[model samples]
Target: MVTEELYAKDSYIKNFSAKVTKIVPSGVILDRTAFHPRGGGLESDTGALILGGNTYRVTEVKFEGNEIVHVLEKLDGLREGDEVEGRIDWERRYRMMRLHTASHIIASIAFSKYNALITGGNITPEYAKDDFNVENKDLLPKIVEEANEIAKRGIKVKVYFLPREEAMKIPGVVKLAEKMPPELETWRIVEIEGIDIQADGGPHVSNTEEIGSIEVIKVENRGKGKKRLYYTVKP
Candidate 1:
């Protein structure tokens, strides 16, 4: 069964209530969830499920077809149809929100100023890394500096949906070097006003100012035309 994804509309939701739709050996499936599944290069969110006085620690969340599985530390007491409350680890989720937006800021700068395209990336609570299809690793320092300046502008970020045909027509709608947005009827577009716009699904901060600043912690040469930059966000 497809679960209602609460996070799709509002990333700030920290807690929610849902009924247990199913139970597997690994975890339980809720009819609705705010827990973000691990996908789109972002790590899964961890939290706890409350049923009565007992708490089940959510270790990892992932997608299984259309269903979102909330892996739990224990399943001895959970049953299908039971109601439970889900509490997101807000501290961790907030960090990811900041980092995710910072990634977009850096990426947009890299693409616009240097003609680079994102090859790959991963987002975690502590840090974020992105690989670019650019030859000059030296350019990353300038990109980070530019991204910081943009972050200070407090540009409002907007998320909306558009028809696939219409979205594909936009320039730079897909910045990834090797992937495209899932072939859905409508594409979710994340636009960092006046700076960048892309078809994305992961959660992000509502404003660039929330990112505070970005730091280039490390850089690597993946191969010809591929350079990776590791960075972290501070707020």
Candidate 2:
């Protein structure tokens, strides 16, 4: 059975209760989960599961088809049908939320100003790096400045689902040419009001202002027409 992914709808949900639906050597599957699995260039969330008065550290969270598997360090007493409390490491997850949202803002600016497309990207608690299809490295400074300016505007981030067909028609909704979102009937769309909008499945903060300020750490010339920008959100 597929797990209900709460994080897709609510990024701020740090704790949840779920019943074990299946168990394997690797990890356990829950009927519902707030745990964000490793996907979309973002790291999986780390946390602990409390069951029967014992705690199990979630070493990894991954997707097995539509199911979310919470890999544990040890599953000594876990069993199917057992109810458990899942609590995410908020500090780490919050950092990821900020970084992920910042990525969209930065990518949006690059696209608007230079018509660059996001080639690839990754998000971490400490920083985020996005590669864009741009030739000149000199544009990095201006893009960074504009991204920060947008973030400081306190734009409200909204998440909603739309039919795949309708979502595809929205301009600037898909940034990566090769990395399209899964062909689900309904696609989750994250929109930074008046700033950016994209078909995304990853968790993100609810406001651009929550990202504070982004500092460009490094700019790299990956190859012809490829520029990588590494940035961190200042607290």
Each model's number of backbone clashes? Answer: 0, 0
Q: Model 1: per-residue lDDT, tens digit, 1-235?
A: 7899888878999999999999988999998999999998899999999999999999999988877999999998889999999999999999999999898888889888888999899999999999999998999988999899999999999999899999999888888987898879999899999999999888899988999779889999999999999999876
Candidate 1: where is the Cα deviation over 4 Å?
none
lDDT by residue (1-235, candidate 2, tens digit) is 8899999989999999999999988999999999999989899999999987799999889988767899999989888999999999999999999999988987788888788998988898898888989999879878889888888889999999999999999999988846778779999999999889999999999988899888989999999999999989887
Tell me how far the alpha carbon of residue 142 in candidate 1 is from the true structure, in angstroms, after superposition. Answer: 0.4
Each prediction's RMSD to truth? 0.9, 0.9
Clashing pairs in 1: none
Best by lDDT: 1
Model 2 gets an lDDT of 0.91
